[model samples]
Target: MQFQFHPLTRKEATELISWRYDRPLDIYNIKVDTDSLQNTVDFFVDPKNSYFAISSDLHEFTAFCCIGADAQVPGGDYSLDALDIGLGIRPELTSQGLGSPIAIATIDYAKQSFSPQRLRVTIAAFNFRALKVWQNLAFLPVQRFRKQNGGNEYLVFIRNT
Candidate 1:
């Protein structure tokens, strides 16, 4: 499957907020309360943030990706020079063997567009699937820490660009 990346729009952001996942993965769900709707939209639409929507040849929204400072979850020491990134597939698509292609596409897109020195990604410690995928891609574990509110443990992985 070929993936096309495009700047995320306000409409896509709102659509993304509606995506819900099963247990474990549910932590990724984005919620925009009424009061924060505007701010949420602002953060997603701003070009400086590198928020993007990924689609397939059919033009259906398969996933979303974000890179740089915005992708950093709180509590991780991001002082290292690496392009941080995050990727989420639509709920129904999980565990369907699409991870490698989607991830490869996202990595390629990030490398071509950002020209970063290296790439880093943070994953919830419980998400073994993602950890395995990144490891298979040669990303090694670099650090681990709790979320900002002292939530679940998170692992940071890095791979050279």
Candidate 2:
């Protein structure tokens, strides 16, 4: 199938409002907060952040990610010049070989726009799919931290830009 990326708009924001968190994957993998999603959409819709929705055949919003400049590293790791980007695919799309290319596109966009020295990805420790995807894309483990949600902590992956 064909794929393309579109800027998330107000219309898309409204559509996300209807996104049901009932997918089996959501119960175990995704951390969806309605308010946060809405706020992110509102912020990215601004001209400043290069956030976009990935689509198949330019028809469906399969995934979304953001590109930004000089994101502060959470643990004062000055070596990390960029922020770990956020990405999400509709739960139905999981384990379907869609993440790598979409992530590569976002990384390429970030490299072109921000020229960061490094790129990072933070994944929930229990989310094996995400860990594998990021690892496949050459993101190496840099750190880990305890999360209030319990279980294992989040793993941070870093890739030099």
Candidate 3:
């Protein structure tokens, strides 16, 4: 399926604030508190960042992804210069074999938009599905560390762009 990306609008950001995934998947959902929403809106509006709403050929929202440097992930200096990618599938679309496509689309976007030497993704250690998706995309495990906020362990993966 073909995917098209567009700037995330204010209305889309508001709708995202109320999006909630199912039980286990909810753990990976973006925090929708007032502060978080404000930050998200600010990030989305920044042209320097590549945060966007991805839509299918039918113009239905399929996922959200940021393919730039604004992603905060636990890692070392090696990631500082790499294009970082963060993504979330629509709550209703999770586990329907969409992960790989979403990841590929984001990576393709990063490659086209930034032309970075490398691409990096930080995945929660327990999020096996996401890890698998990165692995499938040829991202190699680089490091494992704990997030300062929640102390949850995460793994950093990277691949040459």
Candidate 4:
């Protein structure tokens, strides 16, 4: 599918707040208090977050992406000069072979937008589906670590841009 990316909007952020994923992958769901929709909306709409909404058909919201610090997970070694990438494919769209294209597009976007020397991604260890996609893009394993809050294990991957 052809892809178009644009700055995230309040309406899109509001809709994303309702996207729920199944177990294992459910960890990607937004975790803010549902009572304060404004808080979550503010996150995606904020200029510093670098959030972008993705779509092919004008009427469909395919995915959302973020670059930079907001894309980095806590407790990861972010000392490198790589722009991080964060993406979420609509729950129903997962495992349907869409990740690679979206990811390639995201990397191209990151290059033209950030021009970082490298790129980085931190993913949940159990998310082999995502890991495989990143690996296919040549994002190599850097390290495996738990968050300072001490939750599930996560692996960090990096690749030269």
Candidate 5:
């Protein structure tokens, strides 16, 4: 299947905020308001920040993911040497083998787009599927830490590009 990446517009962000989805990435729990997503989109639209979403060629959003410069990484100050990334596919599409390509493509895109030496993703320990995906994609576990949301520890995996 073919795919394209769209830089979400402010209006699109607001619209997407209301689009309901019963899954892990639900906006409600994240406290993502119109302004937050709007600001996110604004940062993504800026060439200085490396963030984007990948969609199918049919114009459907097959996945949502982003890569942040060091300054944007959750735990530390911005550093040009590393990038923080996150991703989630529609729950309905899980276990369909669509992840491999999208994950790899997103990584390649981030590498080329940001020119960072390392790419990182913080995945929950309970997400076996994601762990497998990251491993299959060659991301090695570098560190593990607890999350405030629960007792689950997040594994910080890294990929050298």
Candidate 6:
């Protein structure tokens, strides 16, 4: 399946916030709370963050990703100057061998948008699937720590751009 990145639209953002994945997959879901859909819409209308709606050749929204400093790492720490990235595939698309393509598109978009020496990704320890995907993409484990909020263990990986 061919994939491409496009600037996230308000409609896409709304759909993203409304999407809910089942059980285990929900663990990695993007958490956004706003009083109204418009508020949620306003949040993503920023130029600084490279927010992209991952779409298929048919222009269907398959995933959402951001390449920016807002990526949260456990303890809010990172050793190197890097572009932090976050990604999420559509709920129904999980475990379907689509993550790799979406990830590659995000990384390629980041590489073209920013000139960081390295790229950093923080993944929940339980998300072994994502860990393997990043590992396959050549991102190496750099740090492992627990989130103070939920105490969920997280692994930070890095790869030179």
* TM-score for each predicted model, relative to the true structure: 0.95, 0.73, 0.86, 0.94, 0.72, 0.89
What's the TM for model 4? 0.94
Question: In lDDT terms, which candidate is top?
Answer: 1
Q: Which ten residues in a row have the lowest lDDT in candidate 4?
A: 55-64
The list of candidate 6 runs beyond 4 A from truth reads 30-36
lDDT of 6 by residue, 1-161 (tens): 67787778888878888888787667665576565768766666565666788889644898888787767665757757888999988887788888788888888888887877899999988888899999999999988888888677899999998
Error of 5 at 153 (Å): 1.5
4 or 6, greater by TM-score: 4
Give per-residue CA lDDT, model 5, range 1-161, as digits (tens).
76566665555444444555455434322346655775655654665554455688634766667666422324423333568887766556667888777888778777776787888877777777778999988899877776555555678887888
The per-prediction CA RMSD against the true structure, in angstroms, equals 1.2, 4.1, 2.3, 1.4, 3.8, 1.9
lDDT tens readout by residue for model 3, 64-86: 88776656564434435777888
TM-score of 3: 0.86
The residue-level lDDT of candidate 2 at 17 comes to 47
Model 5: per-residue Cα lDDT at residue 19:
50
Looking at model 6, residue 157 earns an lDDT score of 93
| Deviation from native of the Cα of residue 141 in model 5, angstroms | 0.3
Deviation from native of the Cα of residue 136 in model 2, angstroms: 1.2
- Top candidate (TM-score): 1
- lDDT, each prediction: 0.91, 0.67, 0.79, 0.87, 0.65, 0.82
* Preferred candidate (TM-score higher): 3 or 4: 4
Candidate 5 error regions (>4 Å): 19-29, 32-49, 69-80, 148-151
lDDT of 4 by residue, 3-68 (tens): 888989998998887889999888888877857778879878998989999897633789889998
Q: Order candidates by lDDT, high to low.
A: 1, 4, 6, 3, 2, 5
Clashes of 3: 0
* Model 2 residue 4 lDDT score: 67
